[model samples]
Target: MLVLLAAVALTAGSVSAQTAPTQDRVLRQGQKGQGRMNMTPEQRADLQAQRLTKQLGLSADQATQVKSIALAEAQEMQSMRSNVMAGTDRRAAMQSMKATRDKYDTQLKAVLTPDQLTKYTQLREQQQERRQDGMENGKMKMKVKS
Candidate 1:
């Protein structure tokens, strides 16, 4: 169970990491030095919580709690990004980010039904695999490994 949670957390990271290159590309093309969408971390978290709610079919209370969890995670991730840029111990910061993501995964699991959790894990793994393949092949072709 612990191993599964770790994998889920790592897969979640990979899913988010997949978007980084696209965002970087946007910045490169934009005339502004820092081309970022005007989104507060809270707003971003709300969007994530909404996505999770749709995917997991969460109840109202669960959605609220998950949004709170997502908001905290977003704040922490921002801090981790700053620390990485500030020449803090990169590896340690990454580990801490992983741990923080794991904590969010654990909380989300508690709020999800057994079936929902199973589906969520599978979805994240599929996304991670898609991302890995896209990186290597220059196109996404979904295939589940045995």
Candidate 2:
């Protein structure tokens, strides 16, 4: 009876362990923009600057510049998003958003080295692909549900 109880306990522990969230799962949830909307523009800028610093080996000056640009971009984006939510024409909003992004990219290029710019471009492309894949997956899931 004791041996059987021990085996049951071990099985229960293993099952719980299997059900526990992994670090990767947690990171994925965060990456899905959970809680992102609540962050202040400064917070968003800081996060972006930190990521760029890590990815591009940015100097302190460069990071500062990047943070400023990110802050401005974040604020602009927030305004644009609010405008769109308030019934502004989506096509016009999208065009404005694209122009904002282009301006931001130009500012970034001025701050980054040539190699860093290349790397940043690649990273942006990867992000775009991921976004497209995520949208496609969402559409597939919606279709499946229907």
Candidate 3:
């Protein structure tokens, strides 16, 4: 009876251990990027600069410049979002956002080497594809619910 109880306890422990990571993964996926939205502009900029540094093998100077640009862009975007939320015309806000992004891209291009720029372009395209796929999937899910 003691051996049987020990085996049962071991099985239960193993099962819970197997399930814990899955539960943690689900929670992580749900909360991913939500915390970033709550971060200050400087924090967001630092995060972006770090990501770019890793992705593009940026030098210290490049990383610093990127961080500066990212901070300005984040602040501008936040202001734009606030304006929209405060009943500003969305179309104009969108245009202004696009202009801001264009300015950012131009600045980024000046900083990156040609090879890095090419890689960055490819990365952007891949991200756009993923975004499109996600939107399509979301539309399909919405249709299924309706």
Query: Over the full model, what C-alpha lDDT does candidate 2 score relative to the true structure?
Result: 0.87
> Which pairs, if any, clash in model 2?
none
Candidate 3 lDDT by residue in tens digits, 1-146: 99999999999999998877674354345336566667778877877787788889999999999999999998999999899999999999999999999998899889999988999899899988977898888842443553
- Which ranges in model 1 have alpha carbons more than 4 Å from their true place? 1-38, 138-146
- The per-model lDDT (C-alpha) reads 0.79, 0.87, 0.84
Instruction: Report the C-alpha lDDT of model 2 over 1-146, residue by residue, as the tens digit.
Output: 99999999999999999999985554345455646677778877877887899899999999999999999999999999999999999999999999998999899889999999999999999988988898888842443553
Off by over 4 Å in 2: 1-30, 139-146
The order by descending lDDT is 2, 3, 1
TM-score of each: 0.66, 0.72, 0.72
Per-residue error (Å), model 3, residue 146: 13
Q: Name the lDDT of candidate 1.
A: 0.79
Per-prediction count of colliding residue pairs? Answer: 0, 0, 0
Q: Which residue pairs show collisions in model 1?
A: none
Better of 1 and 3 by TM-score: 3
